[model samples]
Target: MPLTLPSFHSMQHQQDFFCLSPSDSTMTENDFFKIRPYHNTKKQMPVLAKSRRGMRPMRSSTTSTASQKNRKLRYYSTLPVSKPAITMNHSFHQQGPKKDFISLLPYEVASQIVSYLDLSSLCQASTVSRSWYSISRSNEIWRHLASRWSLNIPQHIYPHQLDWYHLYKQRHILNNRWENGRVATHYLMGHIDSVYCLQFDKQKIITGSRDRTIKFWDLSTYQCVQTLYGHEGSVLCLSYNDHIMVSGSSDTTLIVWNMKTLQPIMRLRGHSAGVLDVCFDDRFIISCSKDKTIRIWDINNGRLLRTIFAHQGPVNAIQLQGNKLVSASGDALIKMWDIMTGECLHKYAGHTRGLACVRYDGTKIVSGSNDKTIKVWDAESGYCLMSCEGHTDLVRTLSFDKDRIVSASYDQSIRVWDIKTGACLLNFQSGHTSWVFDVHFDSTRIVSASQDQRVLVMDFTTGLDTQFL
Candidate 1:
């Protein structure tokens, strides 16, 4: 008789009966079946016996009488009586290799990879795996990211307790809030006349007015807590650091105030005409006046250290950084001066009309003028980098950071520009109903005070409808 063979369906059912060998720890029963060997009655029984050693034999409890008969007949007819029973060992089955390239990398290498991604990309990567989530939340990675954007984390925060990821998210949310124009506006009204200049830190907003008074506002309550009265004429400009403030006025004097007590600490009298602008550091107080001179004074003794004939016209604005100062004058000139020596280091003469406002970081100088144009200059070379034009009237106030410049104008508009290319990024026309007199910004928001007697706060990221008081 011809050799009997099990049907294909019967063979599949029998394959499931192969017992998993506990001794064969390398692979599993499912893995064994993935590359199962084919069997035939005509093949040598010795070769089949050798291969079967890798798997253990298992009897099927569910085999019916007819299935058992078929299995017995097929096995008895296919193998010689002298052959020993074959056992299946699952250890011979090979498993597919792991694909965890990211997890396999060293911790430093993994964090470095995450640092290259932006905030949005880094956030998405955190969801990839548990290991990846931990690596992406590393504080060093986020701190480096914050520094890249020039976003300073508050100094009051404990070093080990800083949450860089949350800090970045908060700024991102605020930026979106401004870009979408969704914000809550609080009106701070106290001055009976036009507000001229303002400075703020984390706790309070200090503003000067043509009403000859300086008001200190509680940022949380939006209420005027203290009104400083001493200046005989309209207070034109102001600067503050730590808990000390320096205010210059049309009275031709500069008063240093203890901001915590809201009282005048000392008064320095030297300017012969209206003081246009003032700034101070820890040791020196500097002021520019309509008298066409810039004076540096010793803050401790209230004595004039030196004076430079700074301009042919009134110096309207001045910014001090360390030992250097930049002044803008009505003669349409922007000059960089060494405060210690009273020597002019560089002069930028690009604006066609008198410069109304000016700011300088160590690297670049930005000036807005009565000619309705804004110019950016290279501080080191005294060369004009770019001229930004858009406002239909005089640009009155300006503020900037590493990436952008924000300007307020008499045209009743506030515009944001890309610092490098000098292209207008945003134009905020509906926020103010009259000339915007002063503006200040940080990484997230822009706040402007207007002649309309209103203060408008805008979110940087969202361009939503403007809210007003």
Candidate 2:
């Protein structure tokens, strides 16, 4: 036995065989090592010069088979493919399933996240993406924020916090009203100092200013109808008697004006100090003063009926209901007096400081105090009901509508409260940039005057911005 090398010569096309070699030889077919050239038959084969024994080559065709196997392995190595890789590569060229993040989030969790953003921020965020827009436009989010913000609108919303440009653009398409809300249609602005008192009679608004003049404002034209001048000093207080407007001044005088003519018919002078407040019944006119006495006058004759020494300190406010005259004083006591006898009937004590103003709503007596509180009392019994507290400064004035209680404070704020529950419903932080002097509410709106030399008219429903003098 001998080993033979494979010949490097061309064979019949596509035909192959197998050969194995262990040793080299020169003579026998098994001992011969031949490597012949493929194109030339006369070329000598390369010889493996060594002894050969027990070695064998089956055929030269096997060399072509080895070359084919090597070529196949090189091609497969260039692109070694797996099942996942092939599927992924093919799928990338086509379409696949889309991911939905919104569907993955629960509705309750999504809603809670949206509720914390303010209204203006929520509105702007809506325009950035479709998903955000859909959530922001929903009624649940809007209603919830509205209720929370509206609870105390004046405290929550400030001018600096609003993005005016974005809000202005969205609200531009609105015609006087947008999205169930109305804009300010009227503005009244004709006061020198704070207009401490305002009385509305049908079409006209009569306002008493600290500038010592009472002005009648025409509602339709938003113009000053008439300027009635008689008070020598700041007109601190005023009251209406259907046709007559009685005003009290810091000059210790009271002037009764004919509402129709806007002319002072009578000037009654008696108080030593400033006449702080005045009120009139059908037959009598009652005036309170810093002189610490309540004066009764004959309304028909402009004659002084009696000067009752009712208070130990300055009488700050007075109100007439039926047969009783309710007065609050710097002595921090509210006293009820009989109109005819000029005798103190009952006294209420509990106010921490001086009572600044008092008013009666047929059944209850409401008083505002320098202690920054409002107290409700049973009008007939003079029993204290509740002391409502929220203001941070002195409560300056108190007024009553049908069921609502309005209070003004030196905190530069006005709060509207439910008369029954004593819960504050809304805060109006307008009128004065300084201390608010007085607040009054009619059936339609709230009116507040402040030391900042202006009066503000606010809409009751929307709790929006104010129109000021």
lDDT of every predicted structure (CA atoms): 0.76, 0.67
Backbone clashes for every candidate come to: 22, 2
Q: For model 2, how does the per-residue alpha-carbon lDDT over 1-469 read when each residue is reduced to its tens digit?
A: 1111122222122211111122222222212211221221243644544545866634443133556666665665567566233232231233465554543567666666776875445544454345555555455665454432222225557655544422332222221222112324244777877677766643667778788888777765768878878888988888885688899899999998886776789999899999888888789889989999999999988899999988889999888887788899999999988888988888999898999989886678899998889999987777888878898888988788556787888888767778888878666554456887777766445566667766666543233222210
| Candidate 1 local lDDT, 5-85, one digit each (tens) | 111111123342122122122322223222222222242322222235667654344323566566666776688768986
Candidate 2 at 238: error in angstroms?
Answer: 1.5
Error of 1 at 212 (Å): 1.3
- The total number of steric clashes, by the backbone 3 Å criterion, in model 2 comes to 2
